[model samples]
Target: MSPAVDVQHIAKAFGQFQAVREATFEVRFGEIFALLGPNGAGKSTTIRMILDIIRPDSGTIRVFGRPLDDAAKNQIGYLPEERGLYKSQKVLDMMTYLGTLKGLKPAESRKRAMSYLERLELADFAKKKVSDLSKGMQQKVQFAVTVMHEPRLLIIDEPFSGLDPVNRMVVKEWLYELRQKGSAIVMSTHQMNQVEEMADRLLMISRGQQRLYGEVQAIREQYAIHAIIVEGQGDWSRLDGVTQVESLNEQRRGAVRLHLRPEVSYDDVLAAIARDDSLTIERFERAVPSLDDIFIQVAEEDAQEVRWLNRREAEREVEKEAV
Candidate 1:
């Protein structure tokens, strides 16, 4: 079967400012696809184009193997970053109304609304006005409304905003359940940790450009450095082929990151450490960078390039004025 969302070289611009230069990716069923980028990096614009809220300047977007149409719209559920709910309305009533808007019958909408509220631990606040609930509670209610109709494609922006750790886990489990039920979820958030936990594949944009796009684990491995993290009682710095040893903790009794020479194989280092009777190895693994590390590295690189481009443009303008 075709992927749930297929965007092919879609580009969009507002006047001379290019919001999305070229974004191409596929979100498959039963997978959470993460859209990542720094602020003003065109993630929102790309999402708008995909949802047909804004048309792309070039290329195309297909939802479930066909061009997005009214029918396709019905199959999509969008939870924008901006929260919009009737503050004066009771939580259950508001959720029910939103569900009906998604094509659920009033009775079914009410039923599902209550069911979701219960699942989200907000059933006690069902009769309370939306404004009466805490921000986190309101966020949960909004989430309940978003999924009450159970669309095939769910697009959520900053889904964990205002949520505490406990509530965050609740929402995470809900998304996983939706994925298991064959819903394709596209999550756009700045929470790198959450994305690392939930997303299967990801597309990262930088200054309207597609910078990285691939399976999450594969991408992490692709950016892996030649190092090892060892936690044990040993003088790691004495190991041959180890260029540097950095302690991971303040007390110096915790794990140490051993930077290896390029020519030295990990196996050789492991063997050498094993031969040293003075060392007691408790844990040993490759030093893989986390998603947060990768995100910051890419963002910093993009910012440097942008600064260089701006300077070059300034020089050209000065030359023209001089002429």
Candidate 2:
């Protein structure tokens, strides 16, 4: 089957500012992909291009193997980060209108809207004006409208923002169920832990530059530094082949992380500990870096490099002027 969404070297700019620089990626059916970036990193601009809210300066975006058009729009759902609804309108009425705009018949729209309202536990507030609902309830109503038409591809920004833990779990589980049913989902959020939990794959951008992209676990393994997590009751810091030791258990008995030196194999560490015969070792496992760690590290490194480049250019200009 063709991919759910294909973005090929798409780029956008605002006058002198390049908003997106050759951003490219794909989302497959039955998968949840995370689009991660810091503020103004072009994630929003990229989404706008995909939705045709704004045209890309270069490259293309295809939805479900076809160029984005009315037909494609009908098969896509978008929950924008700037959550909006007609505050004065009744929840059911607003949803019904939006669903019909997506091409659903009026009767079907109301049916779908009401069904989603009931499923989302907002049935009691169906007739209430959106302004009467709390911020979280309004968000739920917006989500209901976004999905009432049953779009094949879903794009949501900051899906967990403003949601309490209970509601967050509710929405998270619903997205998982949708993906299981073959929906291609793209979520852009700053919640690394949430991404770690649900994202099958991820693409991270920094200042409109691609920093990382891959399966979540595989990306973590790439930056894992070949370390081993162990639980033992001896001087693991001084253990052979263990160049660096970090206490995972707060220096309590037996829980620590050992970083293997370049020339030392993980097997060497295990063998040396075994040969000691006095250490009470319990657990030995490979360590994986967390997404949060990788995100911060990559973004900072990118920023530092950009700063260094700017400084070098400024120095060159100064020297040329003197000459």
Candidate 3:
């Protein structure tokens, strides 16, 4: 089967400023695709283009194996970063109305909205006006409105923009449930921790260009440190083949991060540590870089590229004027 949504060679510009550059990615059924980038890096612009809210300078966007149309749109749910719930309208009523607007039958919309509110632990707030709900509750209510019709594809911007960790997890579980039910989910967020925990595939954009895109685990492995994190007794600094070691913590249970040289395989490091009877190996595991770390690395790399391009352009201007 074709991907739920396919975006190819998408480029968008505002006046002379290019907001997105040749972005290409696919969101498949039953997977959470994380669209990540710093602000103004074109993440939102690309999303808007995909939804047909704005026209792109060049590209093609396909939903359900064909160009997006009214019927195709009905199969997709979009929740923008800036929500617009009717404050004076009762929570359930507002959601049902929006669902109906999305082509869901009013009666079915009401039933599904109630089910979602109850699932999200907001059933008691159904009759309450949207203004009466807390910010997090309102967020969940908006989410309910988005998914009430059970769209086969979901596009969420800043899924957890607000709310404490406890409430964030509540919404996280609901997203997973949607994926389990065979929906393709694409979420854009600055919160790498949530992306690391929930996303299956990740696409990172920098300066409106594609930085990295692949399975989350593969990306982590590709950028993994040739090191191990160990929590042990006695000094690890003296271990042979260990190139560098950084102490992460030493209070409750001593933890140290180890970096290895090219010649030092993880097995070699472990064997050498084992040879030393004075050391007790508590926890020895490979260190995987977090999504936050990868994000910073990619962004810095792209920034350098941008700087180089600017310098080249300046040189060309000087050469042209000199001639």
Best by lDDT: 1
Q: How well does candidate 1 match the true structure in TM-score terms?
A: 0.92
Query: Per-residue lDDT tens digits of candidate 3, residues 1-323?
Result: 99998999999989999899878889999999999999999999988988999988998999899988999999889999998889999998998999898998999989988898998889999999999998888888888788888889999999888767887887788889999999999999999988898999999998899888999999999999889999879888899877788888547468888888877899988898889999998788999988988999988888898899999999999999999
> Regarding TM-score, does 1 or 3 come out ahead?
1
Better of 1 and 2 by TM-score: 2
lDDT of 1 by residue, 1-323 (tens): 99999999988889999999988899999999999999999989988988999999999999999999887877898999998789999988888888887888999999999988888888899999999999988888888877888989999998999889999999899999999999999999999998898999999998899999999999999999999989889788889999999888635477888999999999999999889999988888998888888999999998899899999999999999999
TM-score of each: 0.92, 0.93, 0.91
lDDT of 2 at 31: 95
- Could you give me the TM-score of model 3 versus the true structure? 0.91
RMSD of each: 2.1, 2.2, 2.4
Best by TM-score: 2
User: Candidate 3 vs. truth: CA RMSD?
Assistant: 2.4
Report every candidate's CA lDDT: 0.91, 0.89, 0.90
Model 3 Cα shift for residue 238 (angstroms): 2.8
How many residue pairs clash in model 2?
Answer: 1
Which residues of candidate 2, in runs, are more than 4 Å off?
Answer: 247-255, 274-283
Better of 1 and 2 by lDDT: 1
Query: Model 2's lDDT to the true fold?
Result: 0.89
Clashing pairs in 3: none
